[model samples]
Target: MKKFIMCFVGAMLVLSLAACTPTPVKQSESATEPMVEASTGGASDKVPDPNVEPMEIISVYSSNEDATGLNQAMDAVDELTAQSLVDKLIEYGVLEEGTEVLEFDTKDGIGTLDLSKVPSSGTSGELLMLTAIGNTFTENFELDKLKLLVDGKNYSSGHIEHGDNDYLEYNRDYKKL
Candidate 1:
């Protein structure tokens, strides 16, 4: 019957869409079990080994800056990692020593930063921290935007709330607070 045929076609279409959806990367329960996603593009997705390089220098952004608002520390990319950058920030007094990078991934020019925690600093401090993160990742990875997530969800703190689709842009002019 004509009705049966239409129903079959609609079912097929729904099945096709579901099939085309990309599988999400599963979150690991512990640091020992590292979560891995398949890379669709170049080597940028994989962080280089710290031991194997004619070290590449990367600009590690910091909240510490003078009038021009461009504050950065040059660091050798022994391992290109979100945590490494965070470590640099801590060294520069941007973030606390205990903070950890929960997850970091980049695809199609969008980088995601899932953090174990976001500092309870006030609005200005929060903005500066985000600026440091966004600029550091975008510049180093050649990404267009950076998404900040706390514990696998959109970043929400007493200071700021990012929407589901919200992202941070690379900004170089953030002044010291």
Candidate 2:
């Protein structure tokens, strides 16, 4: 009787742990917002839009790697980076008092921007806006370059933003627009 009771208790404990484990993105709701979990760091998890999911640039046909490194890199990202971009634009006086950020970088290199999220229309130079975002991203992800696309098109501009800067120089407007 004691052995049977012990067996039941162990089974119950095992079941409880299984319950605590996070399930895969299989539910209908999760299908719309596929969560990206950071393997180690407790960073921001990106939820791709159900309307348009972002595509990944993998290692390719020959090497055949998922580029999980890139995915892992993004794990440290959070929504705050997107918010900070908006704030910086406002401080530079390029964005008006309440312009919203469409989208921008995750801790991983993937930038998730919602230009419609900008509180109001932007009031800044396109170049200024471009560099603010490009430079901000390149500063962190030194491995791959960022490709800015607005409404599914390349963020029309030139100048490949580069890292390798000695100073931690990002624009400081200090406003949360």
Candidate 3:
């Protein structure tokens, strides 16, 4: 009876261990068999309607929840133009409402964004705003640097100011705090 009990316990332990082991999934080897494709995250991989205009996926940057650093979110825009991007930023609340992109032009590797109004946020605010805007535009426009203008004039805030030739470089060095 003692030996029988020990054997029964050992067999139960071995069966439990075998249940924990994972089996490898083998793909169908037959060429004529239809293979199931893995999901590409979500519906983003689905085919678009032929009647609808194609849209572009763009990264829209906004201040994080703490309003300290930037966080990126993907957005779809009808066009990749500067106005469209600015509209997206406004929609995300990174830029203030009523902000308009007066002009956007790229020369060489530097791009200029002229806005109707730039928020007058103080030092840290300006920093976050500029970083979010610069990172977004530089990344989307494939620009090395970006210059900002307000009402066709160089942007100047209470805590931050830009010279006649000042430009913001694509700041990808800092991680989100």
Candidate 3 residue pairs that clash: none
Q: What's the TM-score of every candidate structure? A: 0.63, 0.30, 0.72
lDDT-better candidate, 2 vs 3? 3
Give the runs in model 1 whose Cα sits over 4 Å from its true position: 1-53, 65-70, 175-177
Cα lDDT of candidate 1 equals: 0.81
Model 1 clash tally, residue pairs:
1
Total backbone collisions, model 3: 0
Candidate maximizing lDDT: 3
lDDT of 1 by residue, 21-49 (tens): 99996666777966676777887877877
- Residue 156's lDDT in candidate 1: 90
- The residue ranges of model 2 lying beyond 4 angstroms of the native Cα positions read 1-80, 104-112, 117-125, 140-143, 151-153, 156-177
Residues 36-70 of candidate 3: C-alpha lDDT, one tens digit per residue? 77888778877778899889999988888787688
RMSD of 2: 18.8
